[model samples]
Target: MFYTLVKIIHLLCACVVIGYLIYDVFIFSHFKKNRSEVEFIKLKRELLKPSALILGLAFLLLLCSGAYLASFYLGGELGWLESSFQQILVLKISVVGLLFVFTPISFFYILVLKKSDPMRKFYHHLALLICLIALIFAKLMFLF
Candidate 1:
């Protein structure tokens, strides 16, 4: 019962994170046409009243719940260097780490790139791509 509850919370948190990511990528992708960076940012703020706090909270939820789930495989996780499943999990965790690094740079970039700037778009696309890969790896974990 506890595992089931944790698993459900983990899945729900994942959905929140992924849904917000998809929406941000889709909506802002179009701002490149006529919007200045300031205008784009203003529009984004106006549209999404909720601060990034909610996203961060959801991420925290995922982390805590995921950690709880992983604890069930304490031995395997300890020998992650040897087990195939652990190896994959380690990679997923690494990618998620990178996602954290990319997020701050993307959102609060020093230069604040224009919408047309490929690097800005690159960051968003890369994050989603990595998230998708991690999701697949997580599903594969159940097989192992």
Candidate 2:
């Protein structure tokens, strides 16, 4: 029962995180390119706060539930270090860790750095790309 609950939360959070990431990469990028400062600021005020809050909550839920699932289902008894599943899991975790680093940098760029700064755009796009890759690896890990 406990495991089932954790699994549900993990999957739900993953969906939320992935959905937001896709929007950030696709829709938000386009908006950033075409929108004026006032438009962008308005959109950011309307969208970013809620999105960021949801994303943060989703990430936290994912971390907690994922840790529980990993330790409960895949660690110790599974001899995870010796298994392909474990390798894939490790890769997924590493990518997530990279996102942990990239996410804050991207957020700060958006919240603090002026929009005209070229590096802000670069870091945002880079973070999205990394997130997309991480999402792909997560799916692949499940299949493996």
Number of backbone-clashing residue pairs for each candidate, in the order shown: 0, 0
lDDT of 2 by residue, 55-128 (tens): 88998998888887778546666776676778877777777677567556666767787444445545556656
lDDT (tens digit, per residue) of candidate 1 on 1-144:
989999999999999888888888886769746798889889888876784888889889999998898777645547655677787777777877787776566555545753334466577677788889889989886687
Per-model TM against the reference:
0.74, 0.74
Error at 120, model 2, angstroms: 3.6
Task: Supply the TM-score for candidate 2.
Answer: 0.74
> Which residue pairs in candidate 1 collide?
none
Q: Report, for every candidate in turn, its global Cα lDDT versus the true structure.
A: 0.78, 0.74
RMSD to the true structure for each prediction, in A, is: 4.3, 4.0
